[model samples]
Target: MPENGRTDTGPTAEPMIRLEQLTKRYPGQDRPAVDRLDLDVPPGEIVVLLGPSGCGKTTTMKLINRLIEPTSGTILLDGEDVTRADPDALRRRIGYAIQQTGLFPHRSVADNVATVPRMLGWDRKRVAGRVDELLTLVGLDPDTYRGRLPRQLSGGQQQRVGVARALGADPEVMLMDEPFGAIDPLTRETLQNEFLRIQSELGKTIVFVTHDIDEAVKMGDRIAIFNAGSGIEQYDTPERILTEPATPFVSEFVGSGAAIKRLTLSRVGDVPVPDWPSIGQDTHRDERAAAVRAGAREFLPLLDADRRPLGWVPADASGDVLDRGLPIVTRIGPGDSLFAALDAMLAANSSAVVVVDDAGAYRGVLDLETILSTVHTDAGPAVPRPGTVATPGTV
Candidate 1:
């Protein structure tokens, strides 16, 4: 396997997976575990189903893979109805990882990963190659770990093997139930960070279930907070869930630390763009010199014919417009969280990066100072007056 493909192109509207008024009821339970749940998991996104215990989050996830059939409604994958898709066929195409790391006790790690391919009737050599490739992809050394049985490995290592096994068939959609939950706190965080990095590269459409709000906030591209019989309380960015909770239940569930959590969600878009001066790319050298003499800053932002951001060019790099060429640009999408904007900035090694629409064209540079101010602003206090007296402990 060459690892999952990456798309650096702009966002696409096609929903990789969709649930339309999906409902699930168990025999003994009086209420539906998941009630009329409607959600869309856009291509290459991580959507977290978050809630407290017995909130129907797990049920919602299981329904997608058809491990538990829905009582009513439809489930669509890539716009095709999968409500009645064959269980074995559906299961093979959708990767699944649970908190238990359900490895077969009798099998070696390599053989375990080869389970699906073997079931699909792949020959010995292809299965072996796939097992080795998957193991390496999940950060496990194939040579050392491949021959070991599940019992011979540590819990974290076992979990890694479980992840490798799920990805064995190169499934487009992944269903994970607290894949990092059972580990110790430090190990959990390490796994979470590693998963984030992995996801960035793999671009799999992931549906993750978790009871931990912090984990949901940290891991999700968008989060759906459920309220059991009450249905979905909120489905939005982690930042929106923190900054503007949909209900009291959401606020209480997200808890007292939301303001600080907002730091992780708030990005360059939260702040207003400044009215900084700029010139067209075709300006003459005499005009450019005059603009510089008149206090034009270095590294001016460039724009296309539509006033869409292209990138920035250094003032000293070239005096001629044609010589500047197309400016190198990096940007965060409008749908991205503040944290993503920060990551973009750091990756670009610039204090600011361009913000763009769902399409790849530029919006504007979201500077670091703008981000910091949004994070540090008081929760309820009005902007401070120059002569006002300060309260004892309020902003």
Candidate 2:
């Protein structure tokens, strides 16, 4: 056994599921659906198979679940040869979710979720309990949603049921083919977030196929990019692919706004936040004036007695010290996405945003210039210089 929770004995550790010289061809087709594919998905990892349509990403996923028999090559699942296993028994142990949901209209939500467990000869009580548990796992309240038919629910709800059903048997391996593709953008994003949260705890070895580069970047721990004829162009993490494309084809496929996409992955608390002059609301007018004069950005953040951010006032503008600055309706917290910060800035029509802690204490500020600068440089937080313009990037 490896020590300190590490695997060893060689430089390379065996993957949970490995595809060796995997290929697929259809009769009368001009080319193979999947060609000479070699990929490794480690346990407790998500490997997104990303490419344009007809790239054979779906075919690769289908091969794993035995929906499509591979023309050649072997599939090793936990070092076991699945090619010789019974397809029916093999599929029961592997969960599958797809774009259309594929829920049975005649079956209730609970029944749909209970399909695999029942097929596996689980007791009726056990299947029912597992159905409720899986539904709750996917954020559906079994008491409310269990009896509803597929058509009674909205598209998003149906997709949730589909996910719950796929996870019904507690499978260690999951295959998802654009499970959120049919839903609207907002719902799709919500599902993606919820799914990621589930994956974080469950740690299922997942093969997710998608044509959307943004989805791949958001969902993948590592991504495999497929080219024409189902050939893998590159296989690497999202960070590497975004900052360093392996080839011209990858650069083109990722499209423009790659940098902005990286911002979505960043959190406000990941980088060091700078400090600026702040005056307690209870402070005397003269002290407030002094703080304003010492402010870094054009505005000074007013804090309460506890140093919690209240609002802002122009550093140079004169006003009643007791009277607060412009009312800030929106605030960004440490957990907020940088993309969210940019959106908040655009919505507020402000050049800079005040950063605050959970207790509303002033942390720092963010602006376009700061975000742009951080993207280019690897420098740490800047020390405050009185009367200096502050740009908090990536903080």
Candidate 3:
């Protein structure tokens, strides 16, 4: 388990999964689909294998699930060698989700989800209760969708049911191969958000495969970019890959809109804010006027002794003494993504938002001017500053 209590002790001493010198060769193929791939997936992180089709991403995923045997090397699950384990036994302990969803056409939704539990010889009452519980957990009403067949639900709903089926036994690790690829854009985004929520609560170590760069960026804690024949080209945090592509192939794969993508991952704290003058409640009107004369702006952020924000103080006020609620105050946290700050600013009708720390203490403000200027600067790369960790619920 991790120190923060965000991970599980089930796989504490060893990686949730590890592929050491793994490779795969088709019957008559000249080269292996995957080449000596070595990777580690921590207990609560989602590691995405991203590359073009036939780049061995899918082949690598199947090898983990035992759907495809590795031509060479070993696969360890929670420190035990899976290569020698019974295929059914190994699969029962790992959740698997794929593009087609693979729900049984003849079985009711609830019964389909209950397949694993039934196959494992769970009690009748236990299977029924788990079916209902999982149905609700995946956003399907037990009374409404449980009795229906797989053909009865929408494509997106079917995908959700597929996820529910994979999670039936509460497997510690998940293997998702383009699970959202068959759905529409809006549905895909919805599923992605729901998956993120579920992963947070469940703390499953997930290995996700995708060819889309955007999906890779959005859904991965760390991305593994492969170059088909070259093995794993680069494996790093999404921020690092977007900011500093490990190779020319990686840079080209990420494309030209990388800057725009960075904005979504970068937080307000990553950009430097210009110093602005602020007035206190105790300042006299004449003195406030003097400070205003020194600076062009009339409004400033008022902070408490701990550098926590109180509110914005407007210059040329009527009195020297001020009370709480004298200034307008509404802000987002410093850890929020830049997109969130932008949204807050839009909704508040303000140019900036006072950035607060985890304790709600104000740190600084983020404005359009600051964000735009930073984007325009000759900054080498938009590396997430030290001290920033993945947001607890984010992939």
Clashing pairs in 1: 266-338, 267-338
Q: Cα deviation of 19 in candidate 2 (Å)?
A: 0.6
Q: Which candidate wins on lDDT?
A: 2
lDDT string, candidate 1, 341-369, tens digits: 67777887877766666555556667777
> In model 1, which runs have C-alpha deviations exceeding 4 angstroms?
1-12, 265-372, 377-395
Task: Put the candidates in lDDT order, highest first.
Answer: 2, 3, 1
Clashes of each: 2, 1, 0
1-395 per-residue lDDT for model 3 (tens digits): 11011222223446788888887877897877777778777777788888888788888899998899888989999888898789998898888999999999999999989988888899999999999998998899999999999999999999999999999988899999999999999889778867876776777889999999988887787788878673777887787778878788889999998877766676666677567656654655566556655776656666666666676655554453233314554666655566667777788888877777777666666788877776566563354421243342232
TM-score winner between candidates 2 and 3: 2
Give the whole-model CA lDDT for all candidates, comma-separated: 0.74, 0.79, 0.76
For candidate 1, give the lDDT of residue 134. 85
Highest-scoring model, TM-score: 2
